[model samples]
Target: MYREVPSARVRGAVLWWSTSPSWTTPVRILPDGCMDLIWSQRHGLLVAGPDTTAQVGTASPGERYVGLRFPPGTGPAVFGLPAYELRDRRVPLTALWSEGRTRELDERAAYADRPERLLESVAAARLGEAGGPDPVARPLVARLDAGGEVARAAADLGLGPRQLHRRSLALFGYGPKTLARILRMQRALSLLRTGVPAADAAARTGYADQPHLSREIRALTGLPPRTLLTTTP
Candidate 1:
């Protein structure tokens, strides 16, 4: 479904594309210090922010795209975690890269120069074959998806509230509650896009009401739900 090419410039840049049969939603590509260009079947093309989180889904036919991956060292600072963990955090990728605030990592991956190289490298890596979600993050993801309360999810995971906060801050750059809210908002967006009424979507996605959902949507995308739906691409 997705193909990656290695960088030609410095062997650090990689390019990739997803061309599968299934309707792909906007993928929430987590920022791991890598820059990417995503093309969707529905959405034409998108250049990601350094640390910004996006919802990627399958587009219509003929919707294809390319991405450029930066080398480990040269890449932006990415708070390492699944997409669900970065809720409500507005830290920029450039800020992280400039301050050297993240964990010591090789952000400059060989996908930096000449993204076509990513196809080869990604083919070799076989991301599809790399089975299973991250063990540590999976439970959290599941809990959020199931609409479990953050406090309950933490308890179920055998983590104390304070401990969960610490771990979340270290791994996700945000607290667990914030991440949960983000996941809920993403789900709400999907529902809205699919013709669900805003009031219903808000209740299903855990917001206090439509107004609450509106506020969050405005904060994240700088637009209200109606505006976003009208001009998502």
Candidate 2:
């Protein structure tokens, strides 16, 4: 089971929890341009970084996990590392924060009656200390989500292309072009999930054609669009 709630303290964050069922199948985690700070019953505290492609996750049966999902460009403030450094990786919280701090968090997480609340408090505090995420994060994402071109987005953000690319690497773990493609794929998937035809979804989401959509989906998710719709939960 999985569920999420909007964070009351942190902007654009989602507090989520998941439980593994009796079966021991690997779960495919889709790339959603977000990072997560997780506390697991079987593991300890972990940071799940932005993913360029789908990642397979496994848990012991009945395992439970609590997580704070940070929207794109927001993780650096809370985690104190560039997004690119953590991309496609999952590391112990100690790897980023001081051992003492991580230990304290672990202890509190272990004992807290509402661990999700603990995650929210910790993230809110750290983010405040770091002065919050980059200012460009939201507008950039919004521009791209609206099908804006990279050059136009950079111009609108008052940044040169190279400047935008550098900031994007730090904030989103990739260049603006790559981020646009990912965002487009996400849009296509959303339409597909609503039962839109593949061709229509592709056309609406900026793919050249349905075959192009198929190829992009296969590359990012390692599955055909049809398989993804049926397999993803």
Q: Tell me, by lDDT, which candidate is best.
A: 2
Residue 6 in model 2: shift from native, Å? 1.7
lDDT of 2: 0.92
Q: lDDT of all the models against the reference? A: 0.53, 0.92
TM-scores of all candidate predictions against the true structure: 0.52, 0.97
Candidate 2 on 97-119: residue-level lDDT in tens? 89998899899899989999999
Q: Residue 149's C-alpha lDDT in candidate 1? A: 88
The candidate that achieves the highest TM-score relative to the unseen native structure: 2
In candidate 2, position 187 carries an lDDT of 93
| Model 1 Cα lDDT, one tens digit per residue, 5-95 | 5655434456666554455454334323233433333432233433434444345544555555543222222222333333334333333
Q: Candidate 2: misplaced stretches above 4 Å?
A: none
Q: Clashing residue pairs in candidate 2, if any? A: none
Go through the candidates in order and give the clash count of each: 43, 0
- Span of ten consecutive residues with least summed lDDT in model 2: 23-32
